[model samples]
Target: MERKHELNNKKVLVVGLAKSGFAAAKVLVKYGANVIVNDMKELEKNQEAKELINQGVEVHCGSHPLSLLDKPIDFIVKNPGIPYTNPLIDAALEKEIPVFTEVELVSYLTDAEIIGITGSNGKTTTTTLVGLMMENNPKKPIVAGNIGTVLCEVADQTDVDDILVAELSSFQLMGVQSFKPHIGVLLNIFDAHLDYHGTREAYGKAKARLFMNQTEEDFCIFNADDQEVIALVENMKSKKVPFSTKQTLPKGACLNEGFVTFNDERIIAIDEIVLPGEHSLENILAATAAAKIAGADTNQIINVLKTFSGVEHRLQYVDTVEGVKFYNDSKATNILATQKAISAFNQPLILLAGGLDRGNDFDDLIPYLINTKALITFGETAPKLIKTAKEAGIKVIEHVDNVEKAVPVAYECSVSGDVVLLSPACASWDQYPSFEQRGDMFIEAVHKLR
Candidate 1:
């Protein structure tokens, strides 16, 4: 890429050895940087480390020794998940060395305009919609970042005419220094990842980084209804485009007379949209704003909104067993997300909820549990959720061992017309390694009932 000169002969330490780290290390090596990789996993368990070692890069596994900082290191490329509170990271900061996530490398690797999407919820859905909307455009779309693919890898192969549609996490955005998106979309912000961020303010600041480097020429698509989003974008340099479901906006994407409109031009009738929920409507408006700004026509936007159901694990509809429809919303890793999922359906819900206890209560979720027929709780937060269920007057609350166990319990409590929803209002780290695994287990258990 374009910024290879900045990395050539520089000593770059790549912390953490996951997909992002591996991709970062390889890119650093390709740019002629002296790369040193570190991870907590043992060397034998880290196949990526071994492969990198063969590429003339230094590999350090099993520990992040403070001594790694003793050398004259130029900078660090850290995995997004590794918090700044990490001892090595803290030490590096004290020494005035720059630290970054692999996301920072995206700006250096490609000239393609990037459309970055971030929020506490609905990020994946909006990013997916924008990617689909841009499919027929003259500029190709390379979807990457937190949606799974390493962004730098996609950036390396991207041409100047391409567009990078990325679903970014707050963690990934926090490490970016000069990264800027041509079109930045913030769906909504909520209390999330407090354990890593230490406070809601820090989390919002990280999400705001998506537009930090954008100029007045760029566009920032944000939620007009969310006060937190409005407050955060109050002083951004980019041209602000607000989308809302609560009120009609005169100049941005909004609902006008039961239709989705951008700048007062109708795109599609809301009733014809395939995705369910008011939250999905918010995503559609945000995506519509970004897609239209990036040269997508009304027909291109309507095509995806009509056919796209949703990304997997975010209110994804699973198979129907015995007339009981199941939905996998395991990606609902916070109170607001689960609240939105619960509000999506009028069908009596056999809600499956619980996961990592992030020092938050479910009291806020009580108001939305009015129609829930039963609550199946699991993971570290089971007791807390059970308490919330009882307070909500949910009489049929059952505490199960895990998601798979909860599936059968949910089905057992359900009759023909009830909806079984696996929308845990917490992170999946307490039992399953990821939310996708938990969702897969729930899907497998639902299949077993057949």
Candidate 2:
């Protein structure tokens, strides 16, 4: 846990007052860095800003003032979700000042080997599973990044004997410079955050950065089933390890004769796995590949796969109310993610979807809707989703204002053999602060059903 770089008396600007930003500022201060925490919210509303001030770190609230940059700044640790279009970020770049994501900052501060996971979907689940599998490792793996804890918050607590299992996102990977992972996992790439990256190609480039700094000595674990993911690494330099749900790979993880095989070794049976869906299968394969390479034992992999149901909010079963099964997949914040979640079952389905529009085209999901018994829509994208459902020739459709209404109504439209699934193909910001909150509401609503 020794500091790799001296930060004593260095000027560091921690941008955005979110968890990652605040964590980075606290770490910087502990290192004797002169830290300035900037946030757009008013100080009275920003508890994080007040906390940083209490730690002797300077605070700049309300807006990123031009004067904040007037002072000489050393480096910037940015919140992953903060856009480059922010004037403060643009000004920092205009000044040629380097901006770093919390993970990037942690990479320099700790020697603990990183197992970085990234993709449009499944990163959170795969990251959690990998952490669980690696728990039996001597390194004592710690899960961080987009899953919950910012790496900066826990980096100094880890030693060379520890492993940092990070759930990375396109946003986090976009700003990375020298952030290399000893084990890099690319789950699967799809058209996501187009409003942020402006194009699918640009978004793919951001996720591809997860492998940018890896070398021949490092392992790049990727999804071979995803054409985009495979195409994204056509010229990659790292040691390649591909996981697949379809075709069996000669050297990586794959589904071989109903067994989850790792390099031709049968590890676990597909049916015995509690976590359902082909997408979950892919996530397990990816995590298994990464964990095995990271020195996890075969027995450890089998043990975790048989027990690790899933992370919260991704196709998590809520209950069976009146013979209607309820599932929370609120983490399906993109079109493809929702599609994958819904595709998990052959049972009659009452799908509840909608949220912040994000300008996502629902065209790709129409074919998946062909099997739905009913389509309930809500939030900002409700109308669009409803229209797409109708066009797909769905007979039963319901529209509501929010997920609170979508859940109960979806239940009403469901039969005994049907699943009431909340898989919003959009973000939760239109109704709740995060997808977790949205999924929690669905779980709460389902619990209310008699």
Highest lDDT against the true fold, candidate? 1
Candidate 1 — worst ten consecutive residues by lDDT sum? Answer: 1-10
The digit string of per-residue lDDT tens for model 2 on 50-167 reads 8887877788888788678889998888888889988888989999999888877776588889899998888889999999899777889999889978877888788889999998
Query: Which candidate tops TM-score?
Result: 1
Q: List the residue pairs that clash in candidate 2.
A: none
Q: What is the TM-score of candidate 1?
A: 0.98
Candidate 1 lDDT, tens digit per residue, 240-277?
A: 99999989989999999999999999999999999999
Candidate 2, residue 18: how far the Cα is off, in Å: 1.4
Please list the C-alpha lDDT of all candidates, in the order they appear. 0.92, 0.87
Pairs with backbone N, CA or C atoms under 3 Å apart (clashes), candidate 1: none
Q: Estimate each model's TM-score.
A: 0.98, 0.96
Q: What TM-score does prediction 2 earn?
A: 0.96
| lDDT agreement of model 1 with the native | 0.92
